[model samples]
Target: MSAIFNFQSLLTVILLLICTCAYIRSLAPSILDRNKTGLLGIFWKCARIESRLELQ
Candidate 1:
Protein backbone atom coordinates (compact mmCIF):
# COMPACT_ATOMS: atom_id res chain seq x y z
CA MET A 1 0.00 0.00 0.00
CA SER A 2 0.89 3.67 -0.17
CA ALA A 3 1.62 3.75 3.55
CA ILE A 4 4.09 0.92 3.33
CA PHE A 5 5.86 2.60 0.44
CA ASN A 6 6.15 5.85 2.41
CA PHE A 7 7.53 4.01 5.44
CA GLN A 8 10.14 2.29 3.33
CA SER A 9 11.20 5.58 1.80
CA LEU A 10 11.62 7.18 5.19
CA LEU A 11 13.61 4.22 6.48
CA THR A 12 15.94 4.38 3.48
CA VAL A 13 16.59 8.06 4.04
CA ILE A 14 17.35 7.47 7.68
CA LEU A 15 19.77 4.67 6.84
CA LEU A 16 21.53 6.85 4.26
CA LEU A 17 21.98 9.63 6.77
CA ILE A 18 23.45 7.24 9.31
CA CYS A 19 25.87 5.87 6.72
CA THR A 20 26.97 9.37 5.70
CA CYS A 21 27.61 10.37 9.30
CA ALA A 22 29.65 7.22 9.91
CA TYR A 23 31.71 7.87 6.78
CA ILE A 24 32.40 11.43 7.83
CA ARG A 25 33.36 10.31 11.32
CA SER A 26 35.80 7.78 9.91
CA LEU A 27 37.39 10.43 7.71
CA ALA A 28 37.78 12.98 10.54
CA PRO A 29 37.83 11.27 13.90
CA SER A 30 39.42 14.26 15.59
CA ILE A 31 36.21 16.20 15.15
CA LEU A 32 34.46 13.71 17.42
CA ASP A 33 37.42 13.54 19.77
CA ARG A 34 37.27 17.26 20.46
CA ASN A 35 33.60 17.23 21.48
CA LYS A 36 33.68 15.13 24.60
CA THR A 37 30.18 15.97 25.84
CA GLY A 38 28.05 15.30 22.80
CA LEU A 39 26.36 12.12 21.57
CA LEU A 40 29.35 11.28 19.42
CA GLY A 41 31.52 11.76 22.46
CA ILE A 42 29.64 9.01 24.30
CA PHE A 43 30.18 6.72 21.33
CA TRP A 44 33.87 7.63 21.21
CA LYS A 45 34.27 6.86 24.90
CA CYS A 46 32.59 3.50 24.50
CA ALA A 47 34.76 2.68 21.50
CA ARG A 48 37.90 3.57 23.40
CA ILE A 49 36.81 1.37 26.27
CA GLU A 50 36.11 -1.53 23.92
CA SER A 51 39.53 -1.16 22.31
CA ARG A 52 41.23 -1.11 25.68
CA LEU A 53 39.41 -4.26 26.70
CA GLU A 54 40.50 -5.98 23.48
CA LEU A 55 44.12 -5.12 24.18
CA GLN A 56 44.12 -7.03 27.43
Candidate 2:
Protein backbone atom coordinates (compact mmCIF):
# COMPACT_ATOMS: atom_id res chain seq x y z
CA MET A 1 0.00 0.00 0.00
CA SER A 2 2.75 2.43 0.90
CA ALA A 3 4.61 1.56 -2.27
CA ILE A 4 1.54 2.31 -4.31
CA PHE A 5 1.13 5.60 -2.52
CA ASN A 6 4.73 6.51 -3.19
CA PHE A 7 4.34 5.62 -6.83
CA GLN A 8 1.24 7.77 -7.08
CA SER A 9 3.05 10.71 -5.49
CA LEU A 10 5.98 10.32 -7.84
CA LEU A 11 3.70 10.10 -10.82
CA THR A 12 1.90 13.23 -9.74
CA VAL A 13 5.17 15.11 -9.36
CA ILE A 14 6.41 13.98 -12.76
CA LEU A 15 3.10 14.97 -14.35
CA LEU A 16 3.15 18.36 -12.70
CA LEU A 17 6.68 19.01 -13.91
CA ILE A 18 5.79 17.92 -17.43
CA CYS A 19 2.72 20.19 -17.47
CA THR A 20 4.62 23.19 -16.17
CA CYS A 21 7.43 22.63 -18.64
CA ALA A 22 4.96 22.32 -21.49
CA TYR A 23 3.23 25.51 -20.46
CA ILE A 24 6.55 27.34 -20.31
CA ARG A 25 7.53 25.91 -23.69
CA SER A 26 4.31 27.20 -25.18
CA LEU A 27 4.78 30.66 -23.72
CA ALA A 28 8.52 30.96 -24.44
CA PRO A 29 8.25 32.45 -27.91
CA SER A 30 5.87 35.29 -26.98
CA ILE A 31 7.71 35.88 -23.73
CA LEU A 32 11.22 36.05 -25.14
CA ASP A 33 11.08 37.68 -28.54
CA ARG A 34 14.69 38.30 -29.60
CA ASN A 35 13.44 41.22 -31.64
CA LYS A 36 11.40 43.80 -29.79
CA THR A 37 8.84 44.17 -32.61
CA GLY A 38 8.24 40.40 -33.08
CA LEU A 39 4.82 39.73 -34.79
CA LEU A 40 4.35 43.43 -35.43
CA GLY A 41 7.20 43.17 -37.93
CA ILE A 42 5.17 40.61 -39.91
CA PHE A 43 2.24 43.01 -40.15
CA TRP A 44 4.46 45.88 -41.26
CA LYS A 45 5.94 43.78 -44.07
CA CYS A 46 2.52 43.04 -45.68
CA ALA A 47 1.85 44.96 -48.89
CA ARG A 48 -1.62 46.13 -47.85
CA ILE A 49 -0.36 48.02 -44.86
CA GLU A 50 2.43 49.52 -46.92
CA SER A 51 0.00 50.76 -49.59
CA ARG A 52 -2.37 52.06 -46.96
CA LEU A 53 0.47 53.93 -45.34
CA GLU A 54 1.54 55.36 -48.71
CA LEU A 55 -2.06 56.39 -49.44
CA GLN A 56 -2.25 58.25 -46.14
Candidate 3:
Protein backbone atom coordinates (compact mmCIF):
# COMPACT_ATOMS: atom_id res chain seq x y z
CA MET A 1 0.00 0.00 0.00
CA SER A 2 2.77 2.44 0.87
CA ALA A 3 4.60 1.65 -2.35
CA ILE A 4 1.45 2.23 -4.37
CA PHE A 5 0.91 5.59 -2.67
CA ASN A 6 4.49 6.63 -3.40
CA PHE A 7 4.11 5.69 -7.07
CA GLN A 8 0.90 7.66 -7.37
CA SER A 9 2.48 10.70 -5.80
CA LEU A 10 5.43 10.51 -8.17
CA LEU A 11 3.12 10.24 -11.15
CA THR A 12 1.12 13.27 -9.98
CA VAL A 13 4.29 15.32 -9.63
CA ILE A 14 5.46 14.34 -13.11
CA LEU A 15 2.11 15.31 -14.63
CA LEU A 16 2.11 18.63 -12.82
CA LEU A 17 5.57 19.42 -14.13
CA ILE A 18 4.51 18.69 -17.69
CA CYS A 19 1.41 20.86 -17.34
CA THR A 20 3.47 23.75 -15.98
CA CYS A 21 5.95 23.52 -18.80
CA ALA A 22 3.14 23.44 -21.37
CA TYR A 23 1.56 26.54 -19.84
CA ILE A 24 4.85 28.39 -20.10
CA ARG A 25 5.24 27.28 -23.67
CA SER A 26 1.78 28.59 -24.52
CA LEU A 27 2.77 32.02 -23.19
CA ALA A 28 5.76 32.25 -25.52
CA PRO A 29 5.63 34.66 -28.49
CA SER A 30 5.63 31.89 -31.08
CA ILE A 31 4.58 28.38 -30.19
CA LEU A 32 5.13 27.04 -33.68
CA ASP A 33 8.57 28.60 -34.05
CA ARG A 34 10.29 26.49 -31.38
CA ASN A 35 12.10 23.21 -32.03
CA LYS A 36 9.70 20.31 -32.40
CA THR A 37 12.07 17.57 -31.23
CA GLY A 38 11.49 17.08 -27.50
CA LEU A 39 8.41 15.59 -25.89
CA LEU A 40 6.73 18.89 -25.09
CA GLY A 41 7.72 20.45 -28.38
CA ILE A 42 6.31 17.57 -30.37
CA PHE A 43 3.10 17.68 -28.41
CA TRP A 44 2.83 21.43 -28.92
CA LYS A 45 3.38 21.10 -32.65
CA CYS A 46 0.75 18.40 -32.94
CA ALA A 47 -1.70 20.52 -30.99
CA ARG A 48 -1.12 23.52 -33.23
CA ILE A 49 -1.54 21.39 -36.32
CA GLU A 50 -4.80 20.01 -35.04
CA SER A 51 -6.07 23.49 -34.22
CA ARG A 52 -5.20 24.68 -37.70
CA LEU A 53 -7.06 21.77 -39.19
CA GLU A 54 -10.09 22.54 -37.10
CA LEU A 55 -10.10 26.17 -38.17
CA GLN A 56 -10.24 25.21 -41.79
Candidate 4:
Protein backbone atom coordinates (compact mmCIF):
# COMPACT_ATOMS: atom_id res chain seq x y z
CA MET A 1 0.00 0.00 0.00
CA SER A 2 2.76 2.43 0.93
CA ALA A 3 4.73 1.43 -2.18
CA ILE A 4 1.77 2.18 -4.41
CA PHE A 5 1.43 5.61 -2.84
CA ASN A 6 5.11 6.34 -3.40
CA PHE A 7 4.92 5.22 -7.00
CA GLN A 8 1.91 7.43 -7.62
CA SER A 9 3.69 10.43 -6.13
CA LEU A 10 6.75 9.84 -8.30
CA LEU A 11 4.58 9.48 -11.41
CA THR A 12 2.78 12.71 -10.58
CA VAL A 13 6.05 14.58 -10.23
CA ILE A 14 7.33 13.31 -13.57
CA LEU A 15 4.08 14.27 -15.26
CA LEU A 16 4.29 17.76 -13.78
CA LEU A 17 7.84 18.17 -15.04
CA ILE A 18 6.87 17.04 -18.55
CA CYS A 19 3.93 19.44 -18.58
CA THR A 20 6.12 22.33 -17.43
CA CYS A 21 8.70 21.62 -20.12
CA ALA A 22 6.01 21.44 -22.81
CA TYR A 23 4.45 24.70 -21.64
CA ILE A 24 7.81 26.44 -21.64
CA ARG A 25 8.70 25.10 -25.07
CA SER A 26 5.35 26.26 -26.42
CA LEU A 27 6.15 29.80 -25.29
CA ALA A 28 9.65 29.68 -26.86
CA PRO A 29 10.42 31.15 -30.29
CA SER A 30 12.09 27.90 -31.51
CA ILE A 31 8.80 26.02 -31.30
CA LEU A 32 7.12 28.60 -33.53
CA ASP A 33 9.81 28.15 -36.14
CA ARG A 34 9.25 24.35 -36.06
CA ASN A 35 5.51 24.86 -36.44
CA LYS A 36 6.22 26.59 -39.74
CA THR A 37 8.48 23.75 -40.97
CA GLY A 38 7.68 20.55 -39.05
CA LEU A 39 4.99 17.85 -39.11
CA LEU A 40 2.46 20.65 -38.86
CA GLY A 41 3.81 22.01 -42.11
CA ILE A 42 3.09 18.69 -43.80
CA PHE A 43 -0.35 18.56 -42.20
CA TRP A 44 -1.22 21.98 -43.54
CA LYS A 45 0.02 21.01 -46.99
CA CYS A 46 -2.28 17.97 -46.98
CA ALA A 47 -5.19 20.04 -45.73
CA ARG A 48 -4.75 22.46 -48.62
CA ILE A 49 -4.70 19.59 -51.11
CA GLU A 50 -7.87 18.13 -49.64
CA SER A 51 -9.62 21.47 -49.81
CA ARG A 52 -8.67 21.86 -53.42
CA LEU A 53 -9.91 18.35 -54.20
CA GLU A 54 -13.25 19.10 -52.56
CA LEU A 55 -13.59 22.32 -54.50
CA GLN A 56 -12.91 20.63 -57.82
The lDDT of each candidate is 0.61, 0.47, 0.59, 0.52
> What would the per-residue lDDT of candidate 3 be over residues 1-56, giving only the tens digit for each residue?
45346988777765555565456556772664466677657656654554465568
Which of the predicted structures, 1 or 2, would earn the higher lDDT when compared with the native?
Answer: 1
Write model 4 residue lDDT over 1-56, tens digit each, in one string. Answer: 45346988777765555454455444673543456566656433433344455568
Once superposed on the true structure, which residue ranges of model 2 sit more than 4 Å away at CA?
Answer: 1-5, 29-56
lDDT of 2: 0.47
- Expressed as tens digits, the lDDT of each residue in 7-29 for candidate 1 is 88777765555555555556887
TM-score, prediction 2 = 0.42
Top lDDT: which candidate number?
1
Clashing residue pairs in candidate 3, if any?
none
Which residue pairs overlap in candidate 4's backbone? none
Work out the TM-score per prediction.
0.47, 0.42, 0.43, 0.42
Clashes of 2: 0
List runs of model 1 lying over 4 Å from the truth.
Answer: 1-5, 33-56
Best-performing candidate as measured by TM-score? 1
How does candidate 3 score on lDDT? 0.59
Q: Number of clashes in model 3?
A: 0
Error of 2 at 6 (Å): 0.8
